[model samples]
Target: MSTVDQDYQLPGGGANITALPKISLHDHLDGGLRPQTIIELADDIGFALPASEANALGTWFAEKSDSGSLVEYLKTFDLTTAVMQTEAGLTRVAREFVQDLAADGVIYGEIRWAPEQHLARGLTLDQTVEAVQAGLDAGVDDVQSAGKTIRVGQLVSAMRHADRGLEIAELAVRHRDAGVVGFDIAGAEAGFPAGKLREAFDYLAKNFFPATVHAGEADGLESIRGALFDGRALRLGHGVRIAEDLVLESEDGDNSYVSLGPVAQWVKDREIALELSPQSNLQTGAIAQWGNDLIDHPFDILYQLGFTVTVNTDNRLMSNTSLSKELFLLSEAFGYDLTDFEVFQLNAASAAFLSLEEREDLADQITEGFGRA
Candidate 1:
C-alpha cells in the first residue's frame, strides 16, 4: 500500500488533514524518495535491490525499518543514497520530493540530506548542492504552474559517524544564500555525541548559522544536553526521549501528575521544539521506555506540559507515512480535533528556520487554511 494515496480524514468526518496547510521541519530528502524512482535510479546505476518491483521495494523498506532497531532502520538509506550518487539522480529525486510534499499540502518544508554520502560518483560537495537547488527551483516552478504555493529549503547534514562535519558545515554556509538554510548532524546519535563535532558547530555559530541536532532518539538526556550546550542546537531531531527526564508522580481521573527533571524543564521552558515523529519514534525504539503504540508516546505529555511539540514524518518511505497520516494517527490515538491539529501546524511554522516575518506569514496561512477546513 503506497501511503501517497492514503485517504486519511479526521475522525467523525471532521476534516481532511491532507488538505490542511502543514509545515514539515524534520523530513529527510534521502528518506522520502519515491519507490519507483529508486528502482529506476538503481537500475540506471546497476545497483541491486532487495525487491525489483516498486511496490515490493516500498514494502521492503517499511519491513526493514520496522525492526525496532535504529541501526537496522538506518541501513535502508544505503540503497537510497547509492542511487543518488549522480547529478540526474539527485536532481530528479529532489524534484519529485518537492512535488510529493506539495501534493501532501505542505506549505513549507525543510529537506535534510548529507552531501558526503553522495560523493561516490565523483561529484564535489558544491556541485551536489547546486544540482539539488536546481531541482528544488524546478519543483517550485512546477508547483506554481499548477496554481499551488509551496516553499522549500535545504538542511545540509553531516553524518555523525563520519569525519566530515566541518566540511559539510562549510558547504551548508557556502550555499546559505542559494538554497541551504541550516546545518545538521545525523546518524548514530548514541556514541557519536554532538560534542564530537563541536568544531563544526562552533564554525556555524561564528557564521551566525542555525543548527538542529539529532539527539534523544537513539540516545538519552545526556545526548540532548550535549546537543544544546555543545552543538548549540536551535531544535532537536526526534527529541522524544527528552521525556525520560519527566517523572510520573501519579494519575488521577483523566490527569497525570508528573515532575519534570531539570533537562525536561529546561527544554519546555526554553520552548525548544520537539520534532516528534510518532511512527518513526516507535519503529526506532526511541520511546521503548514508554510503549509501542502511538498513544503510548510522550507527545501528549509533552504537549500538555507546554512543550513546543510538532508532528513530523522522519521517513515517509520507511514508515509508509505522510504528515497527514501522522496527524491523523495522532488524532485517532489522542482524540484531537481540528483545533488540536492547528496547534501542531502553528508550532511547526514557528520553529521553521524562516525569518520572523516569513514565519508569521506561514502561521497566517496555516490559520486561514484550517479556518476553511
Candidate 2:
C-alpha cells in the first residue's frame, strides 16, 4: 500500500491511529509533492531528475534528506521547486497535497511554501499565490464530494536568506481574505535570524497578522528568542531546541527536578505551540545534541513540562512518513496511549492559526473522533 493508505495502530493492538482526526500545523508545500507528479512535471518542463522511476525518485529524496546537516537536507528542495514553477504544476500539487492529507486522516492543514522560488518561470508572486489557492479550493471541494471533510489554509513563507521579507509579508497579508492564514520565515535559520527581517515582522504586527516563525530547528536558543521578540511569532515551527535552555537539576528515583531558562519559561508559560516532526527531526539531526534517535527527541520532556507540543510530518515525501506514522512512532518509543495522542491533537487544534471559535470547533471534532476510537 502507499504511504498515505498505510494504517497504523497503537501498541499492543490498540485503536487504529490513522482513523483518528489530526491537525497538521507545519507541513511545507514544496516539501510534500508526490514523486510521480514530480516525474511527470519534470518531463513536461524538460527538467532532468536524479531518478527516472517514481519509486526510485521518492527513495532518492528520502536518502538525500537523511544527511546529518540541515543545509544538506534542504538541497533536495532544488528538484521539487523546479517542477513547481508554473500555474498548473502549483495547482495540481496543492490539490494532491490536501487529498493525501485527507487520506492520512488530517482534518485540517496549513500549507506553507515560498512564492519567490516559483517566480523563476515568469509567474509573479501574486499569481503564484492565486494559483495555489485555486488548487487548495479544488482539493477541499473534492474531499467534500468524497463524503469527507477537510479544511486547509496557506502560510506564505519568506526565505530568510533572501531580501524580500517585507514584500512577501505584504503578499501574505494581501491574500488574507482569499486563503492565506499566516506568515513565516524559513531557510537557513542560524545566521539569518528573525531580527534580520524586522521590517517584515513589524509590518505583519501592525496589520494584526499572525505568524509562526521557523526557529529552534537549525538554530539554538538565540534564534528562538529572535523569533519571539523580533518576529512576534504566535507559534514556533519545530521549536525543539528550546530544550537547550532547560537545566537538569537533580533526579530522585521517579522524581526529577529541572529548571527552565527565561526563554523556555516564556514559551511554556505562554503556551507557544511547538510543531515537532519526529521523523524529520531525526533525519535532519535536529535532535543530535540530545541523541540520535526518536526516543532521544525532546518532545516527551517538553510535553511532560506542560509545553504546548503538537506532532507533525514536516516533509512527508522526504521523510517518507505521514502524520499517522509520526504519532505511531512516538507511541512506540514513549509508550504513549490514546490519552496522550488526543492531547497532542488538541494541542495542535489550539495552536492552529484560526479564530478562537473555529479552534474550539476543531477541538470538539477531535474529541468526538477520538472518543469513538
Candidate 3:
C-alpha cells in the first residue's frame, strides 16, 4: 500500500487523522513533484534522469534521501530542481503540489520556492512569479472542481547565498495582489545569515510584508538572531534548533527542570511560530544534538512551554511524508492524543499568513473537523 493509505487508529480508532482538516505552512514546491512528472518534463526538455520508470525513480529519491548524511540528503534536490527551471516544469509541479496537499487533507497550503533558482531558462524574475501564480490558480480551481476546496498562496523565496534578495523581495511586493502572500530566505544556512539580505528585509519591512527565515536548522541561535533582528521574520522555517536555548537546570527521576536562555525566552514570550518538520528534522540532523529519535525532538518541550509550535512537511518527496504522517509519528513517539494533535493544527491555523478573519475561519474548520473525528 502507498504510505498515504496506511492508517493509524488515533488513541481508540477515534478517526483516521488523514480525514481531518489541516493547514500546511511550510511545504516546498520543488520538493513535492511526482517522479512520473519529472520523467515526462525531463523528456520534453531533453534532460536526463537517474531512472526512466516512475516507481524506480520514486524509490531512487527515497533511497538517496535516506542516507542520513546531510550533503547526500540534499543531492536529491539537484535532480528535482534541474527539472523545475522551466515555466512548464514549474507550473506543473506547483499544480500537482496543491493537488497532492488536497489529497492529504490540507485545506490551506503556503507553497514556497526560490525564483532565483528558476532563472536558468532565461525567464525574468517577474515572469517566474507569474508562471507560479498561474499554476497555483489553476490548482485551486482544479481542487474546487473536484468537489473539494483548497486554497494556496506563493511564498516567494530568495536564496540566502545568492545576490537576488532585494530583487526577489521587490518581485514579491510587486506580485502581492496576485497570489503572493509572504517572503522567505532559503538555501545553505551555515554562513549565509538572514542579515545578508538586510536590504531585502528592509524593503519588506517598509512594505509591511511578512517574512519567514530558514534558521536554527543547519545553524544555531546566531542564525535565528539574524532572522529576527534583520529579517524581522513573522515565522521561523524549521526553528527546531532553538531547543539549544534551553539550559537544563535539574532533573529528578522523570521530572527535569529547565531554564530558558535569553533567546528561548524571547521566542517563547513573543509567540513566534516555529515551523517544525519532524521527518526532515531527523534526516537533516537538525535534532542530532539531543538524539536521533523523535522522542528526543524538542517539539514536545517547545509546545509544552507555550511556543507557537506547528507541524509541517518540509519536503514531501525528499522526506516521503505528508503532514498527516508527521502528526502520526509525533503521536506514536510521544503518546500524544487527539487533544495534542488539535493544538498543533490550531497553532498552524493561527500562524498562517492569512488575515485574522481567514485564520479564525481556519481554526473553526479545524475545530469542527477534529471534533467530528
Candidate 4:
C-alpha cells in the first residue's frame, strides 16, 4: 500500500488512527513531494537524480534523512526542490500533497514552503505563490469530489541564512488574501538567529500578520527566545528544546518537582503551540539530549505540564511517514489512547492560523469526528 493508504490502529487495536480527524501545522511542501512525481518532473527538466526508479529514490531520501545531523537531514531537500522550479511542478506537487493529507485523515493543514528556493528556474516570487495556490485549490476540489473534506493554507517561509527576509515577508503579505495565512523563518536555525530577520518580523507585526518560527529544534532555549522576542512568533515549529529550561528540583515517592525557566514559563502561560514531529525530531537529533527514542522525547512532559503540544509529520517523504503513522508511533511509545490523540488534535485546531470562529468550527469538526470514531 502507499504510505498514506496504510492503516494505523491505536495501540491494542481500538480505533483506526488513519480514520481519525487530525490537524497538521508544520508540514513542508518541498519535503512532501511524491517520489514518482519527482522522477517525472526531473525527467521533464533533464535534471539527473541519484536513483531513477521511484521506490529506490524514496528509499534514498529516507536513508539520507535518517542521519543524526540536521544539516545532513536537510540536504535531502536539494533533490526534491530541483524539479519544483516550474509552475507545473509546483502545482502538481502541491495538489498531491493535499490529497495525501486528506487520505491520511487531516481535516486541516498549514503547508509551509520557501518561495526563494523555487526561483532558480526564473519564476518570480508572485508567480510561485500563485502556482502553489492553484494546486492547493485543485487538491481541495479533488478531496471534496471524493466525498472527503480538507482545508489548507500556505505559510510562506524566508530562508534564515539568505538575507532576503524582508523581501519574502513582503511576498507573503502581498498574497495574504490569496492563499497565504502566515509567515515563518526556516533553514539553519543554529547560527542564524531570528534576530537576523528583525526587519521582516517588524514588517509582519506592523501588517498584523501571524508567524510561526522554527526554533528549539537544532538549537536550544536561546533560539526559542529569539523566535519569541525577535520574531514575535505565534507558534513554535518543533520547540522541543524548551525542555532544557525545565529544571528537575526533587523527587518524592511518586512525584517529581520541576521548575520552568523563563522561556518555558512564557510558552506555557501564553499557550504557544509546539509543533512536535516525533519521527522527524528523532531523525534530526532534535531530541538527542533526551534520548534517541520516541519515548525519550519531552512531548509527554510538555503535554502533562499543560503546554499546548500538537503532533505533525514535518516531512512525509523524507521521514517515510504520515500523520496517522506519527500518532500511532507516539501511542505505541507512550501508551496513549484515543483521548490523548483528540487532545492533540484540539490543540492544533486552536493554534491554527485562522480566525477564532474558524478555529472553533475546526474544533467542532474534530469533536464530532472523534465522537464517531
C-alpha lDDT values of all predictions: 0.92, 0.94, 0.88, 0.95
TM-score of each: 0.98, 0.99, 0.96, 0.99
- Model 1 over residues 242-338: C-alpha lDDT tens digits? 9989998999999889999998898888888999999999999999888988899999989998999999999899999999999999989999989
Global Cα lDDT for candidate 3: 0.88
Those runs of model 1 whose alpha carbons end farther than 4 Å from true positions after fitting are 1-3
**lDDT value, residue 356 of candidate 4:** 98
| Top candidate by lDDT | 4
In order of lDDT, best first, we have 4, 2, 1, 3
- Per-residue lDDT tens digits of candidate 3, residues 226-263? 99999999899999889999888999999989899998
Q: Which prediction has more favorable lDDT, 2 or 4?
A: 4
When 1 and 2 are scored with TM-score, the better candidate is 2
Model 4 lDDT on a 0 to 1 scale: 0.95
Model 3, which residues run further than 4 Å from truth?
A: 1-12
User: Per-residue lDDT tens digits of candidate 2, residues 1-373?
Assistant: 2335588999799999998999999999999988999999999999999999988998999999999889999999999999999999999999999988998899999999999999988999999999999999999998999999999999999999999999999999999999999999999988999999999999999999999999999999999999999999999999999999999999999998999999999999999999999888888889999999899999999999999999999999899999999999999999999899999999999999899999999999999999999
- Residue pairs whose backbone atoms clash in candidate 4: none
